[model samples]
Target: MVEDETDQVTLDLEQFEETKKEDTKPTLGDIFTDRVESLMKHRDIDNVLDDQQHILNNLEMMNEKLKFLNLISQSRYEASVTAFRFHMRLLSGVKKDLDSVFRRIRTLKTKLGVQYPEIMAEVQDKYTVHVSDDDDDE
Candidate 1:
């Protein structure tokens, strides 16, 4: 009876050890599948990062182009303003010259009327004749 009890205890201990080992064992197929899934996830993350980086680079390039265009527009505006100012100055000078010429003509007409009244009258008559001739032609 004692020997039979010892054999039964040894058999139970062996069975317990086998159950523990079975629980700890992972299948080769499960390990391989897990590794493949991990690799796919890593590749997806890498692709996403690459796409983000590409978009950022394009945006940076576009920003630079916009800045360049803005500078060009500002320069063109300044040039246009300068040209307008120059034209205004030229017009002012022309006005002054016209005024001077008109003054000179008026002075000459007054002097001629005082010094040579008969000559001025003859000139005025000739001017009226020329105007009448031009009106008939029209």
Candidate 2:
């Protein structure tokens, strides 16, 4: 009787483990669907934000280098001109990347509007800059 009870308990434990594994095994279709949703939601936003931040950082660095080049060029003309040209090219590339980032962010915001309206609003509000008309009109 003791042996039979132990066997039954072991069997019950094995069944419980099997059930837990079955519950945890996400179906291929379910996994694919989740991946697609994530791509549409978090991944797209993250990629755009990362790209934008990268370009912004590069542009900032280039601006600093340009300032340094200006100071150095005052002393050394030819080297400074070359450095200025290189920095200008880098600035142009950064601008193009920024344009792409803005376009992607816009598209992502529109796509996520229905499902994540609050998130869309928060992102728009957070990232937007209100321009004040403080300059005198000539």
Candidate 3:
């Protein structure tokens, strides 16, 4: 009777072991395929980063423009004076940029003249007066 009971117990343990394997873990190939799918995405991650940088640059420009509006809103006097002053400042910046560009062109012309004097003979300083630094005194 005892021997028969021991044999039955071993058979039951074997059946349990077979049932346990049905709820198996994922294989290495399954994990590797999932990783490969992520790596093979249609859009690269850099595109998202570039989009964010563009948005930030635009937002920074808008913020600078809005600062003028905020300053004018807080003033007790009429906004025309403040606005005119701001416009003058903006014009001054434009003049400075134009002056720098003119200087750069002059430098480039000089460099070119050193190499080939004949090419710069007709290239006169037409924009020099407009971009003069005298206006900055006011």
Best model number under lDDT: 1
* CA lDDT for candidate 3: 0.81
Per-model C-alpha lDDT, please?
0.91, 0.89, 0.81
TM-scores, all candidates, are: 0.46, 0.34, 0.33
Model 3 earns a TM-score of 0.33
Clashing pairs in 1: none
For candidate 1, what's the RMSD?
14.1
In the range 1-138, model 2's lDDT, one tens digit per residue, is 999999999999999989987889788998999898876878787899999999999999999999998888787887778899999999999989998999998787688998899987897788986766996532
Kindly give the number of clashing pairs for every candidate.
0, 0, 0
Top-scoring candidate (TM-score): 1
lDDT of 3 by residue, 10-128 (tens): 99999897887667776899789889878876476578778999999999999998998778776745577788899999999999999899999879878998887765554544333
Deviation of model 1 at 50, angstroms: 9.5
- Runs in model 2 deviating more than 4 A are 1-75, 114-129, 134-138
| Candidate 1 lDDT score relative to the true structure | 0.91
Root-mean-square deviation of every model? 14.1, 35.5, 23.2
Candidate 1 per-residue lDDT over residues 1-138, each given as its tens digit? 999999999999999989987888668987998898877887797899999999999999999999999999999999999999999999999989998999999899999999999999999888854345446332
Residue 39, candidate 3: Cα error in Å is: 99
lDDT for predicted candidate 2 compared with the true structure: 0.89
